[model samples]
Target chain A: MDLNIAVLAGDGIGPEVTQQAIKTLNAIGEVYNHNFTFKDAVVGAAAIDQTGDPLPEKTLKVCLETDAVLFGAIGDPKYDNDPSAKVRPEQGLLKLRKSLGLFTNIRPIKAYPTLIDKSPLKEDRINGTDLTIYRELTGGIYFGEKKLNEEGTVASDLCEYSDFEIERIAHLAFKAARARKKKLTLVDKANVLETSRLWRKVVTKIGESYPDITLDFLFVDNAAMQMILNPNQFDVILTENMFGDIISDEGSVIGGSIGLLASASVGEDHSMFEPIHGSFPQAKGKDIANPIASILSAAMLLEHFKLYEEAKAIHNAVEKALELKVVTTDLDPSSKYTTTKVGDFIADYIANSE
Target chain B: MDLNIAVLAGDGIGPEVTQQAIKTLNAIGEVYNHNFTFKDAVVGAAAIDQTGDPLPEKTLKVCLETDAVLFGAIGDPKYDNDPSAKVRPEQGLLKLRKSLGLFTNIRPIKAYPTLIDKSPLKEDRINGTDLTIYRELTGGIYFGEKKLNEEGTVASDLCEYSDFEIERIAHLAFKAARARKKKLTLVDKANVLETSRLWRKVVTKIGESYPDITLDFLFVDNAAMQMILNPNQFDVILTENMFGDIISDEGSVIGGSIGLLASASVGEDHSMFEPIHGSFPQAKGKDIANPIASILSAAMLLEHFKLYEEAKAIHNAVEKALELKVVTTDLDPSSKYTTTKVGDFIADYIANSE
Candidate 1:
């Protein structure tokens, strides 16, 4: 098999961590006897510095023409601190998502046994907890039409959803549920919001086709509470943009470390995999940022292409790293592992494993 | 001193728990030598069954005529299980809030020493957690204009905020912070939403007037995560309606049990106190429901009227009940204490304590 990948290692520790993911992917390609080609592209602050545009035309072209996009982190304090700045690094990724038609975001939250004690939740509560959030990324409040009155005293944002928008994400969530635990929980404020009622109606209609999968609904507030109280009860959790943003971020902490969470944003024709963590500006050249999130994102990319065995190999390597305590300072302050060293260990394990 | 209290024990366990609260209030009145009068009214499913209206005009009249209101839980499984019901038990509370102009919803979350172990979070994460959330109750998306397109396929809800709405709540939250830890964390999605930016601007301006209080900002997503990761880091949390609903509910569980959470909704001219937990229909007549939340709500009512000494007495008595392990089944299933027994103990403690 042949794979073409577009790499956008944006800023700060992004380049350092993304290099590790690429190294691990190369190892997988070697062991599996596959051809993997990579094309480099500038994005975010780095692109802004070079071309005065965060998502340069050539960069987007590379992403569009590739099999999948392997994205690192974006954002920079230079842009973040200047709130009045006309152009920002975040707008680049938002534009890319719109250009590439990336609509649905998938976030998988799992509590690894070795790290259960590190979670804020009790071991009994967090143990064996595995849930994936299917968040509708493009079509909710975030992208809604916003208004501010001439007096600047009143501001408003519209949260709108059409049946088409709900159908696309619902189908993907149902398919994911069918492949997993055969259960799906739709999080919404159906009793309050008209858009939520539409979401429930559309998701319910879609659920009928997948008769084997169980469908349930929870109000967003109740879902937020339930996420902490009993995380193990969920399988594939689906929600719209704003609710998803809050709940998925809430779910991210249950896994013990933000450094280990990865996410994927997909559309009909394209998908992008990236670590959920931001570019740690303070850890830019420190060789200390955790690489596991980036590496696992590569694993998700493999899974997207139906390379199950290859994905599993990366997963096993990651599990071995956790078991051996070969982690960066974030996971283990006493360990003598650099970002590159952790990547090397995982890549070696992938190549040498039975 | 004279106090006229309106009691609207809506449905299910509402009446039972409210009885406990009324008993405790009576004990406070006797100890403090204050003249207390009680008026009864119906709301929610009970009101619907009796008067065919959730919030009967007679009930609103009773509430408006009183100094303050003591609200028990609302909602019934019958109304909840029916999707097509035109009048829901929840609408009663919504109508009441709107009619009373209850713009600010205040929920205090504290991790009691005795019940800390009951929390799903680890002891270290949840212990010593004390925070208050001032949620804007009457505005934002919940009350925003909603629309469904002619095709019945598109739906939208507008999230709008005005300077007046933000200012009123900001002053209350700032006053709250001044009375406590002198720190105010305003949660909003300012980077994305126009309304949030308005919130940040308004809060920032108001925060300048509170020079002693350290004011900060957090996106709603980050606020949701921080509520669980490090709850003690917060002093006063101010947010819009929806974010408050989610985070307050999330914060409710950190105190070990929702059975111990109390909330107060206040406007300029009116206020209502209630337990955060819903009416448990299963325990309606079983005498097993927890009354601590309702009793604490009564304490809050006293505090609202500037009856600090009387409120402290109720708090001390409730704490004594928890200390003595005279809790309901939710906190301790094997406990032999019934709802009335726990209420009796609290009232007795208030009356007998020197």
Candidate 2:
């Protein structure tokens, strides 16, 4: 098997985590008789500083050429504090997503029994909680037309979504649901927004194709509430871009640390995998950032290719590390392991166990 | 002082719980030297059944003339399940909010130490949890224009917000923060949505007026996740309409039963007080409804009038009933009190003690 991978080691701790994921991937390659080629690309603030474009033409070209892209973190405090700055790091990420045609963001939230104590929810409420989120990445308010008033006192952002956008993502969610728990919970504000109504109508109809998948609808507001109250009741939660953005963040809490969560954004020709956690600018050089999420993202990449055994190996490596208390400070505050050490431990575990 | 309170007992446990609130309100009237008038108004499914209107014109007239409106619950399974039904019950509530100019929906989530075990969250998480949500009712997507495709293949809803809408609601949130812990967190999807950017721009400006209050912003998604991870970090959360709907519902989990929380929808002209819990259509006419939330709504009504003593009296009565183990089945199965019986206990406690 030959794999072409685009590596975007974004700003802050992104490079640090990406290095660990690369090490894990290399170990997987050694164990499995696979040939792999990698291309490094600049993105976010780094790309902006170098090419004056967060997502340079070369970076997009590299991403397009690769089968899957492994992304590190992005964003910098320099851009975050300077709200007046026109070219921000986040713009690069949004642009990269649009350019790559990565429209569906799949975030899996599962509570690990070993880390249940870390969660604020009760054991009963959080235990046995496993759910996936299908977030429409490229549409809704994210891509909507924005306006600022002449007086500057008022600003408006149009949250417009065509039926076409909603249906495409709805189809993905239903398809995923049909394969998994056979339940799809559509989260939208149908009572208020035209887009949500379109979302409900389109998704409700699409759901009919997968008869085994029970369809239910929740107003985005109510869905947020339900996420906390009874997260276990959900199997697959399908939502639009904006709603997905918030709910996905909220869903990550079930796993104890958002740092431990990984997400995948897949389109027709390309796929991108990354940790859901943001670049902690403070942890850029500290060597304390968690690398498990990035490593797990590599696992997801393998799973996407139907490499279930390879994917399970990576997941098991993480689960094993947690079980043995050989984790970064985020998981084991008393441990002396650094980011590099945690990554090394997981890779060694994978290699040795194999 | 005399208060003519119009009671809108919509459907399900609406009549049952409103009966409790009324009894509690009337009991306070005797001790506070306030004459009280309780006029019953039909709304929701009950009204749709009787007058072919969820909120009849006569009912709106009564509400217009009242000092305050205390509502129970609304909606029924029949109306809830059949989404195609033309004269839905929730329409009346939405119309009532728009007509009454009820822009602010205030929900207070406080964990009762005695009932911590009953909460879905861990005891430690719930013990000191106290959150208040000021949800904007008449703006954003819920009220936005909805469109359906010609072929029924697509559905869409527009989510728009004006400068005025954002400003007024932000001011209310800031004011509430000032009275609480001097911290305000604004939740929005500024990373993607233009409406969110408008929200941040306005709220950030409004924040300047209150230098004493520490204002912060979070994407709605992250806010949802954080609400579960470390709810103790928040003081006051201000967000747009759709975000509020979800956050408030998730927030209610801190208090255990949804039936234990009350909400106040306030405007310049009139205000409506009701339980935050939705109408449990299945519980209608069952006498098994928990009236605590409705009773607490009565407490909120008194507080709105700045009748601190009157409000305290009702709150104390409620506390004593809980202390004595005289509560509805939802609270404690040992007592097994009916909705009216629990209401009577609180009313009796207030009348006897005061």
Candidate 3:
């Protein structure tokens, strides 16, 4: 099989960490005897500095022509602190998502056995906790019509959801639940918001088709508490955009380190995989940033194309690295392993391991 | 001082737990040489069962005539499970808030040294966690205009905020911060929502007036993650209705059992105190429900009336109860203490302790 991938190594530590992902992917390509080609494009603050546009036409073109896009972290302190700047680095990624029509964001939160001690939660609370969140990305309050009164005294944002929007994500979430624990919990404020009631109505109708998968409902506030009190009880969580953004970030902490979590944003036609963490501007060119999330993102890219064995191989390598303590400073402060060294270890293990 | 109090012990374990709070308040009255009068009113499912209205006119009249309302719990499985039911038990509380014009909901989350083991988080993470959340209750999406298309294909809820709405709550929160740690963190989605940006602008202006208080900002998503990763960093968290609803509930878990948390809803002219936990239908009449939260609500009621010394005595007595293992089954499963027993112990200690 031949795969063409687009690499958007954005800014700060993004380039450094993304290099490790490319190295590990190359290792997988070698081991699986798959032909792979990659094209690099600038984005985020780096693109703004060079082309005066965060998401350049060339970058979008490259992403469109590829089998999948491998995204690194984006953002820089310079752009983040500037309130006056109109074209921000984050808009680049948002535009890319809109262009690609990526409406569903998949985040898998797992408490690894070896990393339990690293978590803020007690061992028993987070033990054996593995859940994936299917977040509807393009709709909801964030993209709704915003209004500010002429007096500057009042401001509003409309949170809107259509049946078509809810149905598309519900099918994906139900399918993912069918493949995993056969359970899905839809988190919404059905008692208060009309949109949430619609979510329940449409999702319940979708649940009828997948009779084998059990469906449950939890209010968003209760869902937030349950994420901390009993994370293990959840299998697959489905929610609208804002609730997803909040809980997914909350769930990222349950895994002990944000540096180890990866996410995938996919639509009907295009897909993009990226790390959950942002570009650590302070760690730029320091070779001390964690590369595992980026490497795992490459694994997700493989899985998007139905390369199960290749993806499993990458997962096995990651587990081995964790077991051997081949991690960056975030996981083990005393360890001297650099960012590239950790990536090299994982790549080497993938190539040689039986 | 003479005080007239309204008690609305609505449903399930509400009556039993509220009885303990009354007993404790009576003890405080005896020790402080104060005249106290109590009026009983019905709300929630109990009110619905009797008058077919959750918050009857008589109950609102009783509340209006009282110094403050001491609420227990609301909700029942009957109204909760029946989606077709036009009236809900929760509506009683919402209506009461609107009638009383209670715009600010205050919840203080603290990790007791003795009960640290009950928390899901590691000991070090929650050891000294003490934070108060001032939530703007009467506004935001919950009260916003909701719309559903004629075809039932689309649903939307508008989240609107005015400077006046933001200012009233901001002043209360800033005052609370000044009394506590003199640090305030305003949580909002300023990067996205127009309402949030308005919040930032208004709060930033209000913050300048209180120059002694160190004010900061965090996006709602990152704030959710930070609540778990580093809870101790927060002093006073001020947010809008929905963000507060999510984070305050999330913050509740850090102190171990939700049974130990109390909250206060205050307006300019009226105030109400209640336990943050819901009515547990399973624990109704079982004599096993924890009464500490209700008792603490009574303490907050005392504080609202400027009876700090009386409030301190109650706090000391409750702390002693936890220290002596006189807690109910929720805190200690094998202690063999009933709800009334724990309440009796707290009341006795408050009355007799020097």
Candidate 4:
């Protein structure tokens, strides 16, 4: 197989982390006898600094021309603190998603055996907790029509959902659940919001086709509480964009550190994989930031290409690194392992593994 | 001082737990040399059974005539399972909130030393986690205009906020923060939602007036994670209706059991106190439900009337009961105390304290 990968190593520690992911992908390509070509594209604050645009037109063209895009984190303290800034780094990512038609975000959370004690939750509650969230990324309140009155006394955001939008994500979620646990839980506020009620109607209708997969519903409020009390009960959590953003972030803490979670954003025509953690501006160039999430994101990229065995090898390598305490300062603050060293360990394991 | 108290012990364990609150309040009245008149009202499922209305006109009239309403839990499994049920128990509470103009909901969460082990969170993370949430109850998306297209293929819910709505709750929350920790955290999605940006602007402006209070901001998604990761860092969390519904419910699990949390809803004209937990239909007649939340609600009612000493006495008695292992089965499944027994113990403590 031949693949062209666009690397959007945005800012802060993004370049450092994406470099490790590229190395691991290269190793996988060599072992699996696949041809891979990597192209670099500037984005976020880096793109802004160099090209005066957070997402340069050249970068978007590279992403569209490639088979898949591997993204690193994006953000800067300068952009974050200035609320009055005319252009921001986040707008770049949002625009890229819109331009690429990336509508679904997949976040998989697994509690690592060695890292259970790092969680604020008790071990028993977090033990054996593994679930994936299928979030509708491009729709809902975030992208809806936002209006502020002329006098600036009133502000509103419209949360809208169409049947086509719900159906596309529902099929993806149900298929994912059927492949894994044969259960899917749709989280929405059906009792209050018309959009939620429509979600129930459409999802329920679609669920009828997948009779083997059990479908359940939980209000977002109750779902939030259940995420803490009994995370093991969920198989695949499906929700609209806003609820997904909130719940997925909440789920990140279940495994102790956001540094270990990876996500994939996929549409019918395009796909992008990235780490869930933000770019730690303070840790940039320090070689102390964790790269496991970026490495796992590479694994997700493999999975997206249907390279199941290659993805499994990367996941096993991560598990081994974690178990052996060969991690960066974020996971083991007392240790002296640098970011590149930890990534090197994972890559070495992947290269040496059968 | 003379007080008119309306007791609306709605359904299930609501009656059982509320009876205990009344007993404790009566004890306080006697010890403080105050005249107290108790009136009974019907609400929720019980009212549906007797008066064909979840909240009867008589119940509303009684609540209006009183200085404050002492409410129990409300709900039934029958209505919960039947999605088509129009006349539900929750509707009563919604109507009552709107009818009485209860805009700000105050929920105080405290991690008791003895009950800290009940939390899903680690003891260290949950320790010293005492915070209050002032939620805007009657506004935001929950009560906003909802619309569905004629073809039934599209739906939308408007999340609207005005300066007036934000100011009222901001004042209440800021004042509450001043009295306690002098810290206020406004949780919203300001970067995306117009309403949230308005919230930030209004709150930031209002924060200027209270220079002594340290004000901060956290996006709702980050707030959700912080709630579990570092709950002790928060003092007073202020948010809109839907965000409040999610966060407060999530906060309830920090103490391990929902049965230990109490809440107060206040407006310009009236206020009502209730336990944060719902009607436990399964444990209704078992005599095993926890009554501490209800007793604490009564304590909050006392505090609302500026009876600080009386409220302190009730709180001290409840603490003694908990420390002495005189709790109900919910708190101590191995213990032999019943609902009325726990209530009796608390009442006895209040009576004998002076």
Candidate 5:
């Protein structure tokens, strides 16, 4: 089967990482005999540098035409320290989500056995853990009406959610749960936030439509605590954008290394895949930042296309490489291999295994 | 100074743990030459069983009459498993906050060098980590309008925060920062939640009034991650109820055990002190649960009264006692003392300390 992939290597270490992902994908294509085409797009600080628009029309056009987009990291530290800057790189991400209608963000968390000892948690607590998070992407507080009082002294952002926005993501979570462990945890501040209350109401109703699924509600606070104590109890975890942003990062810790995590952000008609790790701008061009997350992202792209065998092949190669200890410094920084070397090892593992 | 302390030993091991706190307080009185009187009150599920009111009128009256209230653990396993129960022991504590106008819940987190290694985090990360959290109590969604659709299927809780609510807590936080390290991190979902944005804006404006205090913002999610990644970076952390409920628990992990934490909920007119840990109904009356948190709560209460020397005396005693291994089983289950035994040792240390 033929697939068209959009590659948006936004800035900093994005291009370097995405290049490794492409190389990994080429290895997968060679082994699996799959046809894949790539289109490059600019976004974030880079898009602003090129066209003075973070989400330019041309970039969105490229994203719209592709079956899936592989995104690298965004944001620059320059934009981060300035509290007064109006057009920041993050705005572009928010705008892209809104424009593309990418309403569901799926972040899968699994603590690999090999890395359990590396986690801050006791090995027993983080061991044998696997879970997926489905965070409602397009709505919630991220897009809410924001106001910084004219004095620039006071700021307020509105967090409003309609039942319609809630239903779509609920369906995604329930569907993801069915394919996993048939359990769904709807994480919300239902005991407090009005938007969260609306989310719970709609999700609960949608849950009834899938009677076979077991569902539970957790206040975001308890959910945060529970994630640390017992991440394994969760199967498909669902939440809004803000909660998702925090929990996903917390979940990243479970993997023992952020570089091992991958995410999928999809909507009713569009989808994108990326590494959950941020731009290690310092790691730019060093060939030292682990590219496995980006490579695993490519694997997830295949899974989205129902190319299960191809996805399994890539995963197996990464797993084998990890067992063999051919990893970047982030995992075992003392390891002799650099980032490109690790990518080469994984790609070689895939090619050899086939 | 003459003071009347209202003591409410609520449930499970409430009386057991509270007894130790009293022992420590009495030691404080004897050693410091302060006049103090203790009044016992009923609250939590036990109060519900007695008068069908969790925070009885008499209890409130006693609390109002007293200079401070010492609260023991609340809730029972019976109430925990039954979600359908209309009135919960937690509701009583929440109600008490609203009724007493306890607008700022202050939780002081300081890592004990002796117990730092007990933490899952590295010693360097936990050492010398002292943070005071000013949680905006009696506002936000905890007191918001809760409604259920007629079908009883859809439950909604409204989270509304007026500028006034944010202003009060913001003032308390800024005051706290001015007195301490002069750094305040406003933890919020400003990018999403309207209440959070309001909190961020109000706090930023409040910072202007106190030029020495450093102010910044962290999305609740990032804050949660940062709390674990490196907690020492913060001095005074201010956030709303829901975020506070979660981050404080996450903060407990920094100290190796929540059992070492203490908290105070102070209002414009009244103040309350309690351990950050809840009723471990299972550990009730077993003489096994740790009471350092309770002992530390007393220390915070003393600090509130401007009895800084007296407060330091108690805190120093606790650190010394823990270093000597006179600790409850929670900290070291095999330690050669029961809960009361450890409390006695601490009280004795305070009394004998020159």
Candidate 6:
């Protein structure tokens, strides 16, 4: 097998962590007799500093030509402080998503047995809790028309959903449910919002095609509570963009550390994988930032490509690292491991795996 | 002191819990040597069942004539099953809020010392966690104009907010912050939504008047994470209606059970107090419903009237009840106390308080 992977090391600790991911990916390729080519491109604040644009056309073209993109974290304190700035690093990522036609965001939230005590949630409640959220990225309130009256007193943002938009994501969610668990929970405020009602109608109609899966509904408020109360009860959660953003971040805490969460954004033709954690500017170049999220993201990229055995190798190594306490300061504050050490350990573990 | 109160025991465990809250309130009146008159009125499913109206004119009249309304949960299994029902128990509550000008909703999330271990969060993370959410109830996307395209392909809900709406809630939150921890955190998505930006601008401007209190900002997603990460860092959380509905419910789980949470809706001239938990129709008539939420709601009602010592009496009694394990099945699955028995104990405790 051969793969052309574009690496967009965005900013801050992105390059350091993504270097580890690349190291791990190369190790996997070596172990499996796969040819993997890595091409580097600048993005986020680093791109802004170099090309005066957060996302350069050359970088996007590199990404489009590649089989899959391994994205590092983006944003910088420089842009974050200046609200009046015309160009921002986050804009690059958002525009890249739109340009690449990436519409569905897949976030896998699982409570690892080794790190269960790290979570704020009781071990009993969080243990065995494994769920993935399929959030529609391109539609809903985030991208809708916003307005402010001339008086500047009233401001409004439209929350719009089309059957076409809902159908596309609903199919992906249902298909994912079929692959993993046979249950899907649609979280929406159906009784109140017209868009949510449409979502229910379309999802229910589409659900008919997936006869093997059971579907259920929970109001957004109740769903939020259920996420904390009994996270183990959920298998796959399907929701709109805004709800997804909120719930996925809430689900991030179930693992106790944001460093362990990995996410993948997919379209019909193109897909990109990245760590859910943002650029930790303070930890940049310090060799202290956790690389597990980035490495896990590479695993997701493998899973996206249907390379199950290869992806499993990466995950197995990660679990082994956690069990052996070969982690960054975030997971084990007293551990004397650097970012590269943990990544090297995982990559070595992957190479050494039968 | 003399007071007239409207009692609306809505549906399911509503009537049962309200009975206990009323018993405790009456006991407070006796202990404080105050003349308190209780006027009973029908609302929610009970009102819809008997008068064919969820909020009868008679009920509104009684509520308008009273100092404050003590409400229980609403909704019925019947209404929940039929989505096409013209009148819902919740409509009455919504209409009641509008009619009474109850624009500000106050939800206090406090983890009890005795029940701290009951929370999904570890004791260290959840102990001494006390925060209040001041949500603007009647505005934002929930009540905004909703539209659907002719082909039923697209749907939109407007999320509109004004300086006036933001200011009204801001003052209350700031005043509460001044009285409590002298810190106010405004949670909104200013970077994305125009309404949230308006909220930040209005709240920031209004915050100038309170030099003694500190004001901060957190995007809704980050706020959701921080709520679980460090709930004790928050004093007063101010957010829009939908965000409030979501975050407050998320905050509820930090305290272990929904049955322990109580809320208040207040405006310039009128106020209404109720438990945050909804009608559990399955638990109706089972003698297993928790009355502490409703009883604590009575304490909030007393506090609303500046009856400090009287409210303290009710809170102290309820705390003693929990400390002694004299709680309903929700708090303790193997508890010997029934709903009425727990209420009786609280009322008796209130009667015996100094």
Model 4, runs deviating above 4 Å: B82-84
Q: Over the full model, what C-alpha lDDT does candidate 5 score relative to the true structure? A: 0.82
DockQ of each: 0.92, 0.61, 0.94, 0.94, 0.37, 0.85
TM-score of 3: 0.98
RMSD of 1: 1.3
Would you list the rank order by DockQ, best first? 3, 4, 1, 6, 2, 5
Backbone clashes in model 2: 16
Candidate 6 has an interface RMSD (Å) of: 0.8
lDDT of 5 by residue, B1-354 (tens): 778999988988778888888899899999989987899999998998898888899998999889999998899877778878877888788888777889988988888888866776666556788999998887665666655555544444555677777888888888888878999999987656666767777778778998999898888878877776678899999998777888887776667778878889998889999987888888887899888888888888888888888888888888888888888877776787898998999899989986
| Candidate 2 docking DockQ | 0.61
| Residue lDDT tens for model 5, A50-159 | 88888899989988888889999898877767898677787777777777788988888888878876776666667788899998887655665555555544444445
Clashes of each: 0, 16, 0, 0, 6, 0
Candidate ranking under lDDT, highest first, comes to 3, 1, 4, 6, 2, 5
lDDT of 2 by residue, A247-346 (tens): 8877887667777899999887789999988889998989999998999899889987878798889999999888988788888789888889889998
Interface Cα RMSD in Å, per prediction = 0.5, 2.6, 0.5, 0.5, 4.1, 0.8
lDDT of 4 by residue, A235-287 (tens): 99999999999999999998998899999999998999999989899989999
Clashing pairs in 5: A141-B192, A155-B201, A157-B194, A329-A333, B119-B256, B329-B333
What's the residue-level lDDT of A335 in candidate 2? 86
For model 4, what is the error of residue A122's alpha carbon versus the real structure, in angstroms, after optimal superposition? Answer: 0.4
lDDT of 5 at B191: 59
Compared with the true structure, what per-residue lDDT tens digits does model 6 show for residues B1-354? 898999998999999999999999999999899888989999999999999999999999999999999999899989878969888889899899999999999999999998987898888888899899999999988899999999888898999988999999899999999878999999999989999999999999999999999999999988888888889999999999999999999999889878988999999999999998888999998988999999999999988888989988988998999999999877888899999999999999888766
> Which ten residues in a row are the worst by lDDT in model 4 chain A?
A78-87
After TM-score superposition, the amount by which residue A91's alpha carbon in candidate 3 deviates from its true location, in angstroms, is 1.6
**Candidate that beats the other on DockQ, 2 or 5, i.e. the better one:** 2
Q: What is the DockQ score, from 0 to 1, of model 4?
A: 0.94
- Point out the higher-scoring one by TM-score: 3 or 6: 3
Question: Candidate 6: misplaced stretches above 4 Å?
Answer: none
Q: lDDT per model, in order?
A: 0.94, 0.84, 0.95, 0.93, 0.82, 0.92
Q: For model 3, how does the per-residue alpha-carbon lDDT over A7-124 read when each residue is reduced to its tens digit? A: 9999999999999999999999899999889899999999999999999999999999998899998998888999898889999999999999999999999898989998999999
Candidate 2: regions farther than 4 A off: A149-156, B78-84, B149-155, B204-212
